[model samples]
Target: MLLRAALAALRRVEPVIVLEQLGSTFFDTALQMVVRDRCANATDPGRSREDSQQKAMTDFFMTYNLILRLTPILPSLLLARLSDRGWRRAPVVSSLCGYLLSRLGLLLVVVFSLPLQLMLGAAALFGLSGGYSAFWSGVMTLVALRSSAGDRAKAMMRVELLYGLAGLVGSLVSGHLFQLYTASLGHGTILLIVGTLLNLLCLILAIVLLQVKHVSSEEPEEKSLLPPTSSNATAVEASVSTNLVNIVLLFVAAFLYDFAVGGAIGMLGPFTLKAPLSWSPTQVGYGNAAGCMIFLTSYIGVILFRRCISDEAMILIGMLSFASGIYLMAFATTTYIFYIARILNLFALIPLPTIRSLLSQQVQPSSCGTALTLLQLTLKFAGLAYIPAFTKLYQNTLDWFPGFIFLLSSIFTVLGMIPISILGWRSAGGKCHVRTQGGKQPRCHLEEVPAGTSQTGTET
Candidate 1:
């Protein structure tokens, strides 16, 4: 019994999620500090130090994030294909390797006082090995495959809860940890070392012990969610076609929302450092911890919301929450006001996981991983446009209105809701039936009509 319990514990992915988020939190703060310091040191005497520092920081991230997003496309696609083919851990294991390498790369830079430009290469390496695009999709696929379709959203929320708590702990402590350094170890070196070691430990855990075998959520029950429909090939084809359309719509919604959130958020790291809120490292940590708090809140939102509303409704609620909060963020020059804006954004994380859950329900278990990865890659492509565009917008409006980008994020988020609305409308009107015997996708289905029958089963 003791050994069985231990094995069961090892099968849980919570430890992996915790360690990964913890290390990432440490790395995020360390990177921000070092990058800002380097840019500050490099400012030309003729230029405004504040303006130059901000511009260079945004410019650096603009390029670095582009590389991070770009390099992941092909590698992520490849990993997803492998994952669909039964190499279930391919993406997670490969992405974790990238994480370890990238952490070590940053560690080397901080410890040796190496040129900051080297991080660009590190980002590329990270992306080439699948990055978050693959890693997160892989994680979602694991949960999606294991959980029943009905429970996918809650399952995802639990994972996010674990992820959030880890990030909270890491963010709360990372600032102080970054400030800790002996004479031998420079500022941030100790932090980087801890992050790297933790990442290494995660990689080791992923390689040696992480379970790959999972029960596919293809039980007889899910296929029977809808009443018995015709077994006609034409009906099946029609259902598939409708599903394809709905899938495309879901993809658009996800893309728009991510573009809004991603673009604005890419600027936030730099935004906090300017003017009235010139936050110290501790404040930065606190701010990050505040952001992490939403994961917990979003989990609760999903749990309670799921009991009362449909998945599409939950997504819209989350979007509205973010849109309102981010719109308010445009006016926040004070830390207190910023926290309030963040609090308003509590339900923001709900959309994507629910979106993932909805997408999983639209397809068969075998293709679930690929569908999830494709959604992530779609968001990645969105990042390409948003990251640079928002950076430039932030740079151009820095003197006049730095919060302009946040307002734009609000607009995109509102626009994103349209697709989901359309999806919800169509779903309500459409007649859907799941195949009970032959396992097939649920996204597209139609009832068969007799030669003289109307869709209502009446004579024409």
Candidate 2:
């Protein structure tokens, strides 16, 4: 049922997200052109009026993109804040209502005037993205808190699978839909209309889903995994413990790795569209579909190998796979090679969920949302930081520059490998134990612990 709700919500909102991104990009490009034209015409005193008009449009476009990017992060921050509190149904309902209002306002704007349309569209995008991020993050955090330690990994895996599937399907369908609509209606306006409607539907569904008992309230005497907040001193100590050197090192490695991957992933669609090598939108969609298919297969592979391979080992392999795959993608001169790279990239991403699960196990349950949010924030910031660089590099050197970017990215991947080996060694040596002792060694458990560490006599 959770999966079903997730899929339904994703299906309704994914198109809006994709269209908003594309529309923003398009407007930004158009705004640049208008600025250039205005500058060229500004030499004539009679053209001053036109120059001012063009300047306004350019300003609006630039502001729109800036706002759109910033908007999504606010919701993430909100979710992080809320996660520290006990989970409740009220926030979910409030967020859903917010989403609906935003969508409705957007629809009205589209029906009225162009200026209103642009303003409302930007606001709607911000609200929707923020709301969705907060809602999903909270939902996942709640689920993690409710599930048993043994089941948490599986649950997270399922969430990842669903998220990946949604992204895959969403990207393909949205690309095709935009392509089809751009011919008949203006791409921006049509996308806004459709996106608004879909979001409204999502709001309705979310409200209905909130009525479920598990979602409505905390279970009786539920032992929350979150750490106790008994005293300011204890809270300070706990926070300090979370900032350990090893944990900081892990965050750095994770940040760089995610930064590189985020840059490559975000640029892929635009690269496909603008590459000297030709590709239709449909073709690009198919390539994405292929990647998703490979990801699904790799996800299953990870589950099967869980008993045989340690989590650290899996992460090392995933990093290598991601580096190699991206480099291949950057240098691929042929469609088949591009497709191969895409598949490998998808396969490389399979270990992410497992790594996240590993990280959760390392922290107190209450701190999971904060820890994960910090990691996510790093990735978000990295994406923003690298996107302009990627765009500038593309403009200057085109295809050649992507290869260099990938090579730089590969270095980060290699750096990540070092930590995995260190962490894996430490885990194998029983250094970071997390479980209570039993009469015998736990079999088929891939948790992090020190070498020669036997849980048979230890307390959790």
Candidate that scores best on TM-score? 1
Residue-by-residue lDDT tens digits, candidate 1, 1-460:
9999987777767778999999999999999999988888557455577988999999999999999999999999999999999988899999999999999999999888899899999999999999999999999998877776567789988999999999999999999999998989988999999999999998888888788656654344324123235467775676667667778889999999999999988899999998879999999999999999999999999888886666778899999999999999999999999999999999999999888887877777778789899999999999999998999889888878999999999999999999999887766556444445467545544553211122443321
Show pairs that collide, candidate 2.
225-366, 226-366, 428-451, 429-450, 429-451, 430-449, 430-450, 430-451, 431-449, 431-450
Query: TM-score, each model?
Result: 0.91, 0.67
120-198 in candidate 2: lDDT tens per residue? 3645554545544455455556556655554455566665565556556654664455343444454334544555565
Per-candidate clashes come to: 2, 10
Full-model lDDT, candidate 1: 0.86
Error of 1 at 208 (Å): 1.0
Regions of candidate 1 where Cα sits further than 4 Å from its true position? 44-47, 216-227, 431-460
Worst 10 residues of 1 by lDDT: 450-459
Clash-forming residue pairs, model 1? 239-444, 239-445
Model 2 accuracy (lDDT, Cα): 0.53
